[model samples]
Target: MIEIVARNGSPEAMLCPAFICDACRKQVMEAGNVIYAVRYPDQSERETSPLFVAHKGACDMAVQQWLAANYPVADGWSDLWDEIDDFLAYLGGNFKRSFAEDADGQYVPHVVVMPATSPKLP
Candidate 1:
């Protein structure tokens, strides 16, 4: 299973931590940009999961391609990819709407973890 999350700090903070994109190696400075926290099947928990943060465009595409090349397709890889795409679309829409409603409002960091499947027996 793969999990994706979008994160940003609260608007009330004096300073927000920088989230650097794993793909592009650049800072993720916008709330509207898509961020992902991928947890593979082998990962037992979200904390231990290898996070793959990237922007919604070219960087994200590169991450997907890399995932496809490294992981097996039969393990629901496509489903995870689709989920990420959907999440990105949702975030984009929400950001636009939020911006229109309150351009000055600061976005808080939030995490959305995907449902985990049954653990593999040793």
Candidate 2:
């Protein structure tokens, strides 16, 4: 679903599950390559969200032209540099799966063998 987010009293486009720029019809992989465009919602009663992602260098002209033809107000559209790999650090931990060599020389799940003297065993 497309959601329009407002930042600093200005509308920002938030494209979810879609990296394609709506303005230039190109993929927006890096966050630093985004130019947000805000306009009035097409629906009157229903709330709408930002639905476009334009490239910074390639879509600059296209975004500007679209904004000029659609929204003449200064606050209608804005550009922002975003971090593309911001979420890459979400899983920060030193965890590794225990594996054992199988007959085929392939890694397999390691079984924890406890001694009979251990209290964990019956």
Please give the lDDT score at residue 12 for candidate 1: 43
Query: Lowest-scoring 10 consecutive residues by lDDT in candidate 1?
Result: 113-122
- Candidate 2 local lDDT, 66-85, one digit each (tens): 53444345634333333334
State each model's CA lDDT, in order: 0.47, 0.39
Model 2 poorest 10 in a row by lDDT: 113-122
Q: Provide the lDDT at 15 for model 2.
A: 37
Which regions of candidate 1 are displaced past 4 Å? Answer: 1-16, 31-49, 76-122
* lDDT of candidate model 1 versus the reference: 0.47
Residue-level lDDT tens digits of model 1 in 1-122: 22333455676435435545556666755531333334344444221223455666777676655544444356534314333455567767887786436768754433344325322211
State residue 63's C-alpha deviation in candidate 1, in Å.
0.8
Taking the candidates one at a time, how many backbone clashes does each contain? 1, 3
